[model samples]
Target chain A: MNLIGLGLVGFSALLLLLFSIAKRKSPVKLRAIPALTRLYRAFGLSVEDGTRLFIALGRESLITPNAGAPLSGLGMLRHLTERTSLSDRPPIAAAGEASLALLAQDTLEAGYQAAGAGEYYQPTTGRLTGMTPFSFAAGAMPILRDESVSASVLIGHFGVEAALLADAAERENAFLVGASDDLSSQAALYASAPEALIGEELFATSAYLGATQSHTASLTVQDILRWLIILALLAGAALKLLGMI
Target chain B: MRAIAVVLAVATGLLVLIGYFIPTLAPIQSMILNWAIILSGAAALVGVFNLIWVHWGKISRREKGSLYSAILLICLIATLIFGMLLGPDDSNMRLLVNSIIVPVEATLMALLAVTLVYASIRLLRRRANLMSVVFLATALLLLIASATLPFGEIGPLNNFVRPWFQHAWALGGARGILIGVALGTLMTGLRVLFGADRPYGGK
Candidate 1:
């Protein structure tokens, strides 16, 4: 048994529990995510402009460690699908994996069902563009260019290939808000996307965009844990300087 | 149905988590992971079929770019036939992978580098923030540091500053992001396991 992992998990569980209790007593205020805010505005603009909102669900597999970002993307998708259900052209969700595409379709259907528009839910709106990153980008570029997309929200596990899609959005003059868990992709996105989520911010979509209570509590826990980690790193540096093991 | 999915997810997740720490449960972990791999492979086939269907719809409807869709189908069928008839380990299959796939992927990667440079130039115009400036400057420094100059062997800039920045600053930032991603993954997984966040059609 790995004692460190166990301890970490235990600590996280405690923080989660405490945060949940605190959240019940008082609402938590999180720092604004500009990208998410821009995305919300883009949704409204798409409806007004009579254009489609494009959402890239990314290239991560459902069972990998990288799935976290795409799962968060799905969380945001739930909110987006609901808000844009009545639009003439609903949000177009493109994924690199079939499972994600299927889930996205289901999410759209569920959103429509919730909004009393179940009959209008079209399966083609959520599509699996390609299984590979570059192919996915290639397939999605035409949609961004031809469909008159008002905005593009890319939240997923992208590599260097993210630049291809981001560039396409720029050429089409679509508002872009992008984020990824991969550091290099995040850096690339920071340059390409007018508003980009950095590092941990990608994980906070549920709290910032969806406003889910548990997700808010989870964010609180994440913040506390980050502060703890920073302190520990600082302490370790000090100890190393002092010649202590 | 949702209840069954949630229950199954929770149970399987717990088992996997437990298997990670217990030597006795390692086999169970492997089994589950193998099942996941198989499922993913099947899903990949589904993705291929979905791609074909989408393209077929465009062709049937005589969409504006239906010609491109037809080209895609022809290439796909040709590759599939060659792959099946000759087998994956055959010389022809290897030649296709080496000649076509490798070069295309390499070209795309090369394009990515150029795109990143263009994006960096536009970063200033886009945001004009301190972070943008820092990002651009760092990128310039790294690019210059890694480049092979005509006057070889620059002392401090090449020897100390470049290595320090690459190893220290870049590595530190990457590690920080990795940690955050790891923590986020853990939290998200736990949430799913506990049925708090459902990606599978539940509230």
Candidate 2:
């Protein structure tokens, strides 16, 4: 990795770990969930009322480490399924890959059974929309435009071009909880609406939203290491500038 | 099998974590990178297979979208043959594919930019709010700054704005976003490692 790139990655990881730990200790909830949850609460109207959550899983993202793995996003999918019991409506898990679709379907199915809500789950809702990003986005637009989606949680490996999907949801007045580990995605998130989840935060969604113990602990470690990296980088940069090396 | 998948996955995860600390471990790094490439390549095949299966099923069932299926299949098979058999090394074949494909893909993608501009216009007509105004203004500025040709006397402007935009957008704005991106990745990896999030048929 280039010096600055490595520095950014190293520092950011440290910061997140630190922040995650401190946040864990606090009883006071940001409720905003780093920004997007508040948007959801405002647009979605009801927290307890049955509302559909749509997750767009990107297939192409798996190729790039910077974008995180598609399977990692599937972990979030599993978490969503597990947490669906707490919500009134089961999330409509959309996948760009059939394998991911099957994984999501099985996970959600198992989760429903685990949550004792097996009867409420529908196989049709959790489906493989298409094999391509544009096709998948086309298939998903109808759900945003036609269906009553209380909150759309797009925590997966999506690309920059799919930003319009989030914009479509916003225009339709749907609460969008979008997350992707792609750099361009973060830029899109910042531009379209700041409610976007950046790199590691996309992975943390299951932990953040579900409030699971392991997720919480892992997030803490991540933040601590991230801060440590940042401090080291700043010092190194300063030393280099002063010709201390 | 499930237990094995879990064990392998956990081992892979731990190796990756440890490998991060031991920067000199090129083999570990390569293994992780290779795994990523293999898994992703496998997933792409899954996409192609599904596409073919779905199209074939549509044709058999005489579905309403069967015609679209025919077009899709023709494109898919043609592209596959062109790519695999002839290979992109053949300039003539590459030109043939690019001549048709590039324009089509570009046109479709161009629709998005059009839609964005159109939507912004509609929003401005409706809202005229501060945030909306800022959004429209920044987009316009970016578009104009990017697309306009700075010839002759305007060379200085281009030189000045290009570096400024590069640093501000690429370095500054990008840094904050990268932080969030790193956090999301670390969390997802952690989740999978802890078995709190099982992705690969793990129990």
* The candidate that achieves the highest lDDT relative to the unseen native structure: 1
Q: In angstroms, how far off is B95's CA in candidate 2? A: 8.5
Q: Give the residue spans of candidate 1 off by over 4 A.
A: none
Model 1, B119-202: lDDT tens digits are 888889989989888888888887788888889756787889899998999899899989888888778776776677778776
Residue lDDT tens for model 2, B21-92 = 666765886788787777766766765665577567667888766776788789878878878887878897
The 10 consecutive residues of candidate 2 chain B with the worst lDDT sum are B148-157
Provide chain B's TM-score, model 2: 0.75
Q: Give the Cα lDDT of each candidate.
A: 0.84, 0.64
Give the range where candidate 2 chain A is weakest over 10 consecutive residues by summed lDDT. A38-47
Candidate 2 per-residue C-alpha lDDT over A148-187 given as tens digits, one digit per residue, 9 for 90 to 100 = 6766766666666566777778777776766666666655
Per-residue C-alpha lDDT of model 1 across residues A32-81, encoded as one tens digit per residue? 77778877888898988789999999988877868888888888888888
